[model samples]
Target: MDTPALIADDLVVLRGGRKTVDGASLTVAPGEIYALLGGNGAGKSTTLFAILGLIKRSSGVIQVAGHDPEVAPDAVRAAAAYLPENVALYDHLSALENIRYFLGLAGQTRTGAELDQAFDAVKLAPAARTRRVSGFSKGMRQKTAIALALLRQTPVLLLDEPTSGLDPAAARDFHDLLIDLRKRRVATLMVTHDLFGAADTADRIGVLQGGRIAQEWTAAAQGPRFDIQALHQSYAGPDAA
Candidate 1:
């Protein structure tokens, strides 16, 4: 059996005596895209933080590429790439420059040609490569961050609200980039409230409610993969009875 690229089994995280994430378990296999959906205070981003070792877990087994975050944080980090809702880049620096600088921080380097190729893969315009990101759009900044993730070459990716502010056209474009990553054998786990976007892009979808996986749906091998209306109904249902 192929080992999962990311794993969170019976995970629990507490903040000030309250469980932010309680017994949430999920996995993203190689080349798979898993979308986690939840409403406000659902602890979606908290889950990502635990996987990245940014926050300590109260209990549970969490692993990235076979390494435990608590035991080997460096290995876990090396095997995963994270993209938060806000893609932060130096406003005064160009896209290429920002990528180069961040890569340097990670003790890695890419030739100029390689950098351009990464940008191309993310659909970042050639014209915008040298322009300072101070004037870039949300979509543009996102593309640049994705390009950085591509250069990092991690097998697992964790995205938080990836399409939050994107327009319809831009969201579709971002979905295409994610599909491209899947082809490259990257395992992606994204948390978002965009039901339609998840229905469009995810190989599997899970609803998080009451700090656990309330339900899950997998893409069918034949016919329609998901029933959008049904999912919306389930998602729209009250978190508590």
Candidate 2:
């Protein structure tokens, strides 16, 4: 069997001598979209940071593209494309220019036509490609960031609250972009508060509580079905009843 694109087995992270991420385990297979659902302080972002090797893992294993993040941080980074909540871009640069500049920083050089295609793949308007990102809407900016991810063509993708501020239509567009990535076999792990979006986009969903995955659901198992109410209840916790 092919190795999973991302995996965290019994992962733990300590902050101030306390375990913020406690024995959380999950996997994202190639072409899979896994949503890690949680409220604030649930250790969602910490787990992602650990996978990126941004923080020292107090214990357990983390692999990005089959390489340990701690032992081979460079390999893990090369294999993953991360889109944080607020994607940072040069305000003065046009969409095309931004992608070109960042790609060059990663030691990649692509022609103008190829860059245009990447923007197109992410559904960015051709007209907007020449406009400075400083004036772009949140959705437009996100598409630009995703366009860069397309150029990178990494095997693993990490997203944090990717749809936080978008309206319904833009959120839908973002979800569609992720589906396209899935077709290309990019394993995606997203931390989100968007329950409906998670149900709609993820092949599997894991609910995190107190830094551990307390519940998991698979679309295939649900099959043409999803109960947002149940998901909300799970998210609401035992006291919500």
Candidate 3:
């Protein structure tokens, strides 16, 4: 198997003297999507932040594309694209403008044609490319952000609540975009509460409970990828189930 694009080994993160992520470990292989599923305060987002080097890990190891985020944050970030729960784009700027601005910030430059191509890859409407993002729907904003990620050519993607706020049709389109990214060998690690979305999109799903990985499930070769009922029981806790 290829070296994992992302790795968190015995990961631990603390906030205010409490362990937010305690010994949570997982991996995302190139061209694979791994969904980290949990409810509120389950340390899912904390795990993502630790990988991004935004939050210092109390202990354990983290490697993004062979670079340690704590040791070489710049290199780690360069090799990864992160989309937070709320994609931050200048509402006043058009989609192309937003992409251009971010690329410039990254010290990378792309021509007009390349920018358009990225937008096309994400299936953002041609007409919307030149309009202010303030008028765009949540899905449109997500597409614009993803286009920026594509232009960066990042090998890994970290997404937090990627499918939240999207309608069924828009979510499906977003999943298709993820499939294309997988085909391009981008390893994706997404944290979400969307069980249905995770079941439909992820090659593997890890359940995070009480700040640790409680259990995990992998997709099957044929038929349904998951037993939704079982997955739900795991996610909702035995009492809730």
lDDT of 2 by residue, 1-241 (tens): 6578899999999988888999999999999999999889899999999999999998998989989988999999999999999989999999989999999888998887888888878788999999999999999999999999999989999999999999999899899989999999999999999998988989899998887999998886645646777877888765664
* TM-score of each model, in listed order: 0.97, 0.96, 0.97
lDDT of each: 0.93, 0.91, 0.93
Task: Write candidate 3's Cα lDDT for 1-241 as tens digits.
Answer: 9899999999999999999999999999999999999889989989999999999999999999999999999999999999998999999999988988999999999988988888888889899999999999999999999999999999999999998999999899889888899999999998998898889999999999888899999999999999999999888977755
Badly placed stretches (over 4 Å) of model 2 are: 221-225, 238-241
Q: In model 1, how large is the Cα lDDT of residue 57?
A: 98
Residue 131 of model 1 has an lDDT of 99
lDDT of 3 at 151: 95
Error of 3 at 17 (Å): 0.8
In model 1, which regions exceed 4 Å deviation?
Answer: 238-241
The residue pairs that clash in candidate 2, if any, are none
Task: State residue 13's C-alpha deviation in candidate 2, in Å.
Answer: 0.3
